[model samples]
Target: MYEYKCVELRSKMFGGALSGDKLERVLNEWAAKGWQLKSTAAVDVKGRIGPGGTDGLLITFERQKG
Candidate 1:
């Protein structure tokens, strides 16, 4: 069996921008906890922006259930 986890990366967490280094650190931390990245999605806060002005990233992860 497998377990899943979801992490929300908000732009505001990095002063309104998501930096690669910061993201890597977060991912690495999860990896240390035995979670593997599964997928990612850009989440827009509003529909009127036409995919612009994304609020953050939705990161999905999975791992074996021990």
Candidate 2:
């Protein structure tokens, strides 16, 4: 069987774009721990004090369970 992990990535800048560098860093970090990318999805996450939501990414990873 396999295990999975999910991570939510939000833009650091307000009304700006998500950082490619940040995404790469997270991918590499997980890779180092033997996790392989499973999938990614775009989503709008609601904020604490807003009627709207913020753009974000839902990253999923998987690895064989030992």
Candidate 3:
């Protein structure tokens, strides 16, 4: 069975405001890359890899079988 997890992403840096639907669209795009859609509840984190504290949870296709 596939599993899901929560995710979070910032907007201001992306140029446009982020919406829940937008996040879903992202999730779908990510699914194409093999990451399953888990959750969208994101918390705040400081700093960033790019402009606008750009960071969020990514997905993995293979579960750790723990």
Candidate 2 structure quality by residue, lDDT tens digits, 1-66 = 999999887664324677778788889999999999999999887767869778889899999999
Query: Candidate 3, residues 5-54: lDDT per residue as tens digits?
Result: 44446664445466667766876776776675544444454544645454
Compose the digit string of candidate 1's lDDT tens values, residues 4-35: 99888878778888989999999999999999
Using lDDT, give the best candidate's number. 1
Full candidate order by TM-score, most accurate first: 1, 2, 3
Q: Find the candidate with the highest TM-score and give its number.
A: 1
Candidate 3 clash pair list = 4-38, 5-38, 5-39
lDDT of each: 0.87, 0.85, 0.53
TM-score between model 1 and native: 0.82
What pairs collide in candidate 1? none
Which ranges of candidate 3 are over 4 A from the true structure? Answer: 1-8, 49-66
Give the per-residue Cα lDDT of candidate 2 at 59: 95
User: Residue 36's C-alpha lDDT in candidate 1?
Assistant: 98
Where does candidate 2 have its weakest 10-residue lDDT segment? 10-19
